[model samples]
Target: MTTLFKAPAKDKAALEEGAALSPRFDGSGLVTAVVADSHDNEILMLAHMNEEALRLTIETGIAHYWSRSRNSLWKKGETSGNLQMVDEIRFDCDQDAVLLKVRVGGADATCHTGRRSCFYRKVVTDGGQTRLEIDAEPRFDPTTVYTDH
Candidate 1:
């Protein structure tokens, strides 16, 4: 059977170098992207995974990310229980970014405002005036979605 985690031929050298030089959380500047997924192609969410997050994701099969805004580590669905179950991870040819296809579990949406995804809204210009409109309703209310523990 074919393995999903096999290193690409092109990335083999870099992976080896990274493993040797910066093995553990040294941020080797390799692995520029992470594409997580469940069985299907539904994208639960998309986030940048740094070296630490990448290692953790590979080790645990859970989505971990580097929060640019929070400037810290973030495990997906930690607070909302809308966990992203990673089925597979893939990289682009250039290894610049990742496409995360994941299974979104629980009631919470991927969007911060509690929408199904951050792409829930579509921008349009009316009479040459740009206006933001509600293209889609929130999949679930975050307040009720997450119970206090």
Candidate 2:
């Protein structure tokens, strides 16, 4: 694999407020990523990426993430049929976060629960209690798709 451009050391001006693509990874060597649909710009999910995952995403034009639960690099929708083809990748001013606009294929789903987006639930405060309400139904049956999980 080709080495990506090295991130410059944290310099207040360059790191926090610059136009350069000098990503500031956290102690775990990971950066936060927010993904959304390219057409509608609907938020899909939030993930993390390591150096390799970030490099691969830029090189391949496919969304890739570092799975904290699995502790490995994962191509989004590798298991399910909904692959995300990156259309545009943007970094925050601090370069500590990324935003991905992607066109999805197959089921056009992004959540592991077979939902179109991971943010399918809305937080509601009812009777002075916080709760989640499902706003969207599953696009596909996760029980049938994710048999292993």
Candidate 3:
């Protein structure tokens, strides 16, 4: 892809409030991406994006992330039909991270485990031990949806 966004520069004003989309990637050539529901602003998932993923998302107005586990680029909901359509993209103070407000398409789910959001579990302490509590129910069935897990 052509260079649509410039690399982060030294100008404070430009870095903070500039028209140029200068994203500061980490040493791994990644920038943290936080996805949220556009209607309710509820956080869906946290992922990372390489330059190629970032470019596709911007060009297509869809959510694309670099799958660290898979070590490749993937469009969210491609397999499960839970595609996230970009409504807006915001950057952190230093531009090291991004927040994507999206309108979920298809099943309206974000997690591969068949939940509306990846953050379906809540951390809890019980009997002096930390555990996860199921805060949300599964919106779909992973068994029928994903084959590889």
Candidate 4:
């Protein structure tokens, strides 16, 4: 693949203030990616990106991520038709993380579970026990939408 990003600046000043985008990847060669809805700013999911995923996102204007669980690169919603069209991309001052504002297509879902967002559960404590409560409804049925699931 073609090289699209510069090597991270060694000096803190250049890294923080420079116009060049030099992402500081972690020891695992990945960077954190926070995705959100462009219109409402609803957080959709948290993902990771390797160099290639970042490059593809920039070039294609679509959100691409590194799947730590699958050990592979993933194009968001490629299978379920929930593609995330990136509206904007921003990096933290330290360049260790990225934020993608996007518009979701199809079912407007971002979670593999067919939910509108991956963060569909809320942590709650009841009777001294911690449990998860459903905060959002699924937009589509996973069994019907994703044959592989």
- TM-scores of all candidate predictions against the true structure: 0.67, 0.93, 0.93, 0.94
Clashes of each: 2, 0, 0, 0
* Model 4, residue pairs in steric clash: none
- Listed per candidate, the RMSD to the true structure in angstroms reads 6.5, 1.4, 1.4, 1.2
How high a TM-score does candidate 1 get?
A: 0.67
* Winning candidate number (lDDT): 4
- Of models 1 and 3, which has the larger lDDT? 3
- CA lDDT of 140 in candidate 1? 74
Worst 10 residues of 1 by lDDT: 17-26
Whose TM-score is greatest here? 4
Candidate 2 stretches with Cα past 4 Å from truth are none
Candidate 2 displacement at residue 100 in angstroms: 0.4
lDDT of 3: 0.91
Question: Residue by residue across 36-138, what tens digits does model 4's lDDT show?
Answer: 9999999999999999999999999999999999999999888899999999999999899999999999999999888988999999999999999997989
Whole-model Cα lDDT of every candidate shown, in order: 0.61, 0.89, 0.91, 0.94
Residue lDDT tens for model 1, 57-98: 767877788887777878988888777767666655434456
Of the candidates numbered 2 and 3, which has the greater lDDT value?
3
Residue-level lDDT of model 3, residues 20-133, one tens digit each, is 789999899999999999899999999999999998998999999999999989988899888989999988888999999999987788888888999988999988999988
